[model samples]
Target: MNLFQDIRALVIGALEIMQADGVIPVGLDFANVTVEPPRDPAHGDMATNAAMVLAKPAKMKPRDIAEALAGHLAADYRVDTAEVAGPGFLNLRLSPALWQGLVKSVLSSGEGFGRSTLGAGQRVNVEFVSANPTGPLHVGHTRGAVFGDALASLLDHAGYDVTREYYINDGGAQVDVLARSVYLRYLEAHGQEVAFEDGTYPGEYLIEVGEALRRKVGDAYVGKPEDVWLEPIRDFATDAMMGLIRADLKSLGVEMDVFFSEKSLYGTGLIEQALDALDAKGLLYEGVLEPPKGKMPDDWEPREQTLFKSTEHGDDVDRPVKKSDGGWTYFAPDIAYHYDKVSRGFDALIDVFGADHGGYVKRMKAAVSALSDGRVPLDVKLCQLVKLWKNGEPFKMSKRAGNFVTLRDVVELVGADVTRFVMLTRKNDAPLDFDFDKVLEQSRDNPVFYVQYAHARVCSVQRKAQEAGIVVDDAMLAAADLTKLDHEAEIAVAKKIAEWPRLVEIAARTHEPHRVAFYLFELASDLHGLWNKGHDDPSLRFLQEDDVDTSQAKIALARAVAVVISAGLGILGVTPADEMR
Candidate 1:
């Protein structure tokens, strides 16, 4: 149960009672009313803006409405006191029993305690880490991959039907570059010396691809011309690159439900079908007769080209779908792809792109808008760059990836859990500094270990309790006399546990998985604070001296914290450590 939601329901109920008693008008929009944890815990456990939002609409002063609402809320047993605070805001203090009971709910629900149905089973297609199939995934793609996977899991926890997708960039010129690169490697495999030109990939990762090609073809095309071997090598190289990419993604615990290929849209007429759907809606035309503003290209000239009327939706300019030479621009294929997504009957589309693609957001949204007739919504999230630091110095390029740090390199250094957690420690659109040393540190300053340490400590306590002949199983703990859990510090930890359900909804609604990481940090802090308090006060210890009943009650609270931590870490694709070693 969400205590914040419960309190909001109480506030709404109180307002309804006030209306029934004729203390206020009968009709006022309560949609804006919300109960959230006060910014400062010093204020109260929860705060509501019901009075402030309804004052102007009800033709009553905020204080006047707050006083009436507070008086009515104070009658509920769950709310200890509802005090009207500054500008008609109501601060609520819940009864200790309510927070104590939350611990029981958490233990009874186990890993499913914080799961929410806020999404209501809506179909959401999340396309992410669609890196070009030119090479193995690098560190930048690692960040996007982790973020997208966690987001899909977060939405799934919130009850959305999520489909994780990866769009292979095999239809671009980059794959041809890969083909030429591999062909050179193939020459070397046949005892021919070759120099990699500026356009060809020279990474050591492709050496194995070359060796494998030599094994499969037995040097049959070693001396063939470009026209004879280019097409076959291009297909072979792309498949090899995809294999490497899949391995890199698997190393970081990411799995995609769909691997859509840009090449497939070429032969299947899907691109034409998508554009025809938009053209039928009068959103497509053959006209792009204006030069870009401010800085025109040296080759700039007004040419009639196929354009989409994206300006009518929400774009800076009408975007070109076909170039003057009758070839589809990059934006055209992208528009057709999204148009196909809309026609596939998805309720929503979310694209996780790098920050460099920020300029494409508005036009892409406009295309989806015009194609779906404003019925389907698209959310584009831009992930910023990840800067790696080691030994307090910026890390240079990797030897394996040749130019940049490969995803495998990062995962190898810190393992998958630390790599995943550190990637999500910052907001998606903000720059992230990933320090190798800090993430591996064992202290409380390292949030990943700190959260895992809390879970491990609980496991240690359970072992100790079992050795002492105490019953700490779920059934026993759920039936424990929880009234013994009355210490101030113990109740405080339970209060943090009560925030899980509410935190899930907030993180899922905002499409921000980092919030789960932040909440896990705070929850760990609460647990550690309470654990430290036990060193000073023996009564607060989770394991009592020969008092089985009281010990089970306290142990139940500790297990409840572990439940939430495990669930949150599961969403992040981090395995919760049962022991630090």
Candidate 2:
């Protein structure tokens, strides 16, 4: 039902016929040939580079080949006219009947109309929002959570087997800091005074964790040394912080399929096994890394360490896996984690990290490349910072999260639907400004409102048609006389609908769910444009007064727009509005 794909197939068939008639060479590769929507709608419904791409390869002039191909395409009933533009680019204007029939197809298919099979069922692991398990998630994590969840859903829509994952950073010095902070709160519950040092967390959120620990142990560790209670308290505090993080993600409608722990790779042979696999490939060796460029650190030293040959796989330099003191560096666990993912037999891997982690991308990709022998591809997406504004000033920090605004704070003020949609209004790598007053404004400048209003308008039309005793359900509207929708404005909306499947494939291929948000806005503009035109000409209205047959035809087109909008919003994890208020 993809009109662009259907027309491309028609063009390819014509080229093959020309080759058979000896009009062109027989062995030209047609893979480079493409049929896409013209940049300007006035050019034609679709444009193809078949003539231009084949001209040099076929040893013939582009115009000569375009003239012969146009003749063959003109014979098809679906093609209205095939015209050659600059440099022998072929533009095809499809018949209005083709666009009219697309309305029926959209109604019959419902939301499933634009689903694609681009990934061919490949298993893809999407790891995102893997914030350290030390506190509640902040606004930075919110962007990553929304981006990752939407990406997983988009891959699922495009036929990829997607697994949403979170990696817990529990095996680190930060958890030790959390443990001592909880101990301070525990002492406070036992009628003792304690001061939080610079290294300990001082957030009010951990006060409950302290109270819960006092209730569980009955002050057993109140006067104990650090060695006696540090280990057990570290485990307890990590579990509590993870519980808080789970609740925060649930509030924003994000759920993970797996929660991996960095500690699991320790006390086990997993890290050794991963490094050994690389060593077996002749990629690991004992060497001293070159000093970093520019000013040297006060503690900088050149010492022999166990390093990986990351540069061979495309990194800027070989990276250290083990420090000079025989302890694993931070990069070791990351390499081991990706190795475990490769061992799980996933076809591909994606990591959604904060923008600060941009430097780690190449080395991590190299690790996966060497681990899987280039079989599994890894793509890392970094989400930039989000600036919050309210009442013409910067938003205040959250006391609950200590120094940052918690994810729950944003969701409480705007609700989950608005929070999710607004987070995706910008590209992941671009800084986003989330303005409370502007996002809530009911106008075209607000993308979430504009898209939702289109869906709500269609619902209003259906209710009016039902009250007039005319059936407007999907099954009935799909059977309407769609040829009655021959007006140019109405046809334009149908043209926008025709781009849905193609847009889905492109967005999924690029691993950019923001494209879906962009396409939804454009489609809404077309739907609203046609709605405004109906006021000037009563015959163009969706619900024609006292005409049942014509009303069904027009209503069918509007419902098709809603179907696409609901599907797009569903991919973004936002609930479509049936009424704006």
**Candidate lDDT values, in order:** 0.91, 0.95
Question: Residue 123 of model 2: what lDDT?
Answer: 99
Compared with the true structure, what per-residue lDDT tens digits does model 2 show for residues 1-581?
79888999999999999999999999999999999999998999999999999999899999999989999998899999999999899888999999999999999999999998889999999999999988899999999999999999999999999999999999889999999999999999888989989778888899999999999999799789999999999999999999999999999999999999999999799999999999999999999999989999899989999999999999999999999998999999999999999999999999999999999999999999999999999999999999999999999999977889989999999888889899999999999999988889899999989999999999999998999999999999999999999999999999999999999999999999999899999999999999999889898999998889899999999999999999999999999999989
The sequence of per-residue lDDT tens digits that candidate 1 reaches over residues 1-581 is 78888888888888888889988899888999999889998888889999999999899999999999988888889989999998899998888889888888888889999899999999999999999988878888989999999999999999999999999988889988999999988888988999999778988888898988999998788788889988999999999999999999999999999998888878677778878887898988988567777988999888899888889999988888888898888887898788778878989999999989999999999999988899889999999999999999998888766788899989999999999999999999999999999999999989999999999999999999999999899878988999888887888788888889999999998999999999999999998888899899989888999899999999999999999999999999999999998
What range of 10 consecutive residues in model 1 has the weakest lDDT sum? Answer: 284-293
Q: Could you tally the backbone clashes for each prediction?
A: 0, 0
Candidate closest to the true structure, highest TM-score: 2
Q: Residue 488 of candidate 2: its Cα lDDT? A: 93
Task: Give the clashing pairs for model 1.
Answer: none
lDDT of 2 at 398: 90
lDDT of 1 at 570: 98
